[model samples]
Target: MSRNIPLLDLQKEFEMLKPELMPALEEVLSSARFIMGPQLDELNDHIQSLLGVKHHIPCANGTDALLIALKALDIQPGDEVITTPFTFVATAETIAFAGAVPVFTDIRSDTCLMDPNLIEERITEKTKAIIPVHLFGQMVPMEPVMTIAKKYGLKVIEDTAQAIGATQHGCFAGTIGDIGTISYFPSKNLGAYGDAGGIVTNNDSLAETCALIANHGQAHKYEHHLIGLNSRMDSLQAAILNVKIKYLEEWNILRAEKAAWYHKYLDPSVETPVTVPGNTHIYHQYTIKVDQRDALKEYLAGQGIATAVHYPIPLNEQPAIAALKLHGFPTPVAAKTAQRVLSLPMNQYLSEEDIRYVADAVNSFLNTKKSQSFQNSPTGSSV
Candidate 1:
């Protein structure tokens, strides 16, 4: 029987951390404080120290984190927020949810990040913010984005759902922009046991606003200043994350090692991920570009090797975005990318032997396709 490898082996991760995890959970349970408890406060302090971010505000999930950010920045209806259309919908959805128009931008074919060059043309008088999504485990080139934001006098929100520890020029992903949002989705690099998220900022006012916005806009008891959402992170999720945070860097490093194995073992014909200059890629997804991506995914599935498409469609072309009646932009690269991008099994738990097995399966399929194609061509002269 073929061995089955999963895209994210969270169960294995949980087993590895269970020693500390159980004790932490016991402590949270013993304290009987579930909401914004000591565990959450401790996690906040640890995150601030670990990432060197000035302010950390915990939320229910990444989407709320983004929404909190937009509301904190006072983004109004009809305002425009420029962002790439290639990433998860939450990056764009929060903009629309905040009653702002999402201005679509193209992404770079190599890094699949919002092309800074393509951003200026999309900026309009109504443009209020630029959301640079750090797709995968890599941080987008923030300097150029920051420069553009400064020039346009627009707020910058780093959609860092997939890139928590990722850094650019030694600065953490969410800290470079005006505000950064993170998701603790189970599949993320620093994921929690349940839904958890955070907002980070260097500005004290933005920090305060985020905290208020996340907890129903009550600075003090029953003193509502602005409308807000009930998006506070619970104690149990915080306790779980606290146990996992210590291993985050180690896991990120291991993921990079696993990515290297995929490169070394896979056929050279395959297009692997490319890390942007001055960026540290945590390989949140070891995605590759290939012809007949769906076929390859199905082949891998049959081999008991799981695979995924990080995104199979661009946001601008999606039914929901279309419903907004938003003007379309030239997203040729993002559109092409949606059809070709495929993510292979990637986790710290994957061993070299596991990777080798998966790679052999991939090479076998591609090589066979090549052979068949050659044989069918007019110039074929197979033995």
Candidate 2:
């Protein structure tokens, strides 16, 4: 059997960092202080410096990061938070978790981030914040979102889970908003060995508030300030993250190079991905628009090239959120995007040969159009 191409190859990344990573892990293990330790503090400082933000609060996962941000801002039940539908459910899920209603906004057909133009129509007295997710490692056009937030007295929480290092013009994704959340989940650009996430902010008070909330609402040991969740990043994950942080810029540069290679090589008929105007893309997933996404995905699998759909369902249509009773909301773009989006193999570890192989596999799959076989044997292996 031939080697299968992985959607993301974390083992290759791990091998690259083993020399420095192992020692860090050893030190954390020796300390035995798993929760809030020196490793966590170091990783927080490293992320803060890299993103040029004043405060970094380490959390257990990205979802908790957003929830903490919303909690810190005093967003409550019945408050409306505007967000795009064409992203991971966590963006909206966290809004609901914050006890606020997620007002679904349409996305830009090209960029797939929140359509800043459509925001005003959704605003109402209940509106408290706008979460413009930096989807697929590209910064959501922050200037317009910020302007609208300023005009309406709305808070902006940047869902930067997929765009830790991505920027628009000269501004970084997480820093542009009042607060931002990033995931260091195994698949992220700056991934940890396991699940990990962080919140970044320029405001000192907001940072302290989120940190307190993440630690079971305690500002000090055994003292509960408010009802909060326990969501602290483990020392082991932080130790791994601290080692990886040093290589982030170099890895992001390689990812950019691979994205360029894909652009140069992938078939033009495939509707290759496009970046938001004036925004830098970190190519987290390298998603392309394909008319026959399911068929092509199957064909690629047959060729040992793994592929995935970043999101196959729009958030508004999710069964969990249907009770909100949102309808006739210009969801055509989101629906179409769900059917058409296909993520190709993307990681800093992919070599020139791997890039060409995946590109060729996609173009070949498109040319062959194996519709019947795909329909007949649609396996659930796009992991």
Candidate 3:
């Protein structure tokens, strides 16, 4: 029997772009400078220009980008960084990696992004920074989050992992915070062939620090400045990104169009996704909440449709979170969201027929109360 549709078809993406990609790969192979080469520099310059930021430091991956940003801000042991538990593990894991504690801030139930209003309540003497994840490509309430951050003198790191080209209130998603991190994972909107990540910042001091940290703490050859990790972006990956970056806007537009279709065609029995005001989303995952998430997912799978869960367990409920055990985190919204949210197969390459098939399957499943066979897996790779 033939299989159901896969979540994303990277092979198809490559096939469509092979003409442009082949030459770039050949150029990189000819240069033979694999690390921190001209290709990487060119890609960084392109990202900086596109995002309207001063510095765009390319790194090994998104997780490392966040780690470097935290390190640059001088986050250390005993410092508390406020973040949402409804996002990918990397959002909080980077804070922990920087020897800081990730204080779980709940999300807005509607947008599933961090609730800026709740951030102040979590801030304490130990709170040194706030990392608001732009979850599912929707911008967080940044104007309010920034106001709270400025009042408290805390660094803000926007985790734009799933929202590279997304915009809000006429400004880009990654440009709103002091420092922003973006992933070029294979499945992202502007993903590369393998792992790649970039950090954007307007602060000169922070940019210098991030660059140094990603380069083994080296200011010069054999001259170590600070303790750091080896997290440089490779030239080959940069070449791949250079080719894809040009199409990000168009591809994201396609994703947005597909999302609109889903929103219009979703079963009346199911609750649809919520879009925040003044946000122009890229629709990274096109996620939605429903009454019977697992059942719906399975039903879709049986009908040759694929679905995923952005997160099934809130951060507070995770085994890694028990160690911190903060008093009264109150993740009621995050916890409830974890159980009901589901992500349909969303990609720039998806067709109108594909969207209709998935929607029809969903409506059918919801009506008959019959579920298809599928694993209720978490969306984030680390999870």
Quote model 1's TM-score.
0.98
| Worst 10-residue lDDT window, candidate 1 | 374-383
Give the runs in model 3 whose Cα sits over 4 Å from its true position: 1-3, 370-383
Instruction: Report each candidate's C-alpha RMSD, comma-separated, in the order given.
Output: 1.2, 5.2, 6.3
Quote the lDDT for 362 in model 3. 78
lDDT (Cα, tens digit) per residue for candidate 3, span 1-383: 32467688889889999999999999889988888789988997899888888989999999999999988988888799999999888888878777889898888888898888899999898899999898888788799989998999999999999998888888887787889999999888889888989999999999999999999889999899988889998899999999989999998899899998987787766676788888888888888898789978877778777889999998778887767665547889999999999989888777887888788877877766533222233433334
For lDDT, the strongest prediction is 1
Candidate 2 TM-score, true structure as reference: 0.94
Query: Which window of 10 residues has the lowest lDDT sum in candidate 3?
Result: 372-381
Clash pairs detected, candidate 3: 298-372, 299-372
Q: lDDT by residue for model 1 over 95-214, one digit each (tens)?
A: 999899999989999888999998999988999999999999998888889899999999999999999899988998899999999999999999988898999999999999999999
Would you list the clashing residue pairs of candidate 2?
none
Judged by whole-model lDDT over C-alpha atoms, candidate 1 comes out at 0.92
Give all candidates' CA lDDT scores: 0.92, 0.87, 0.86
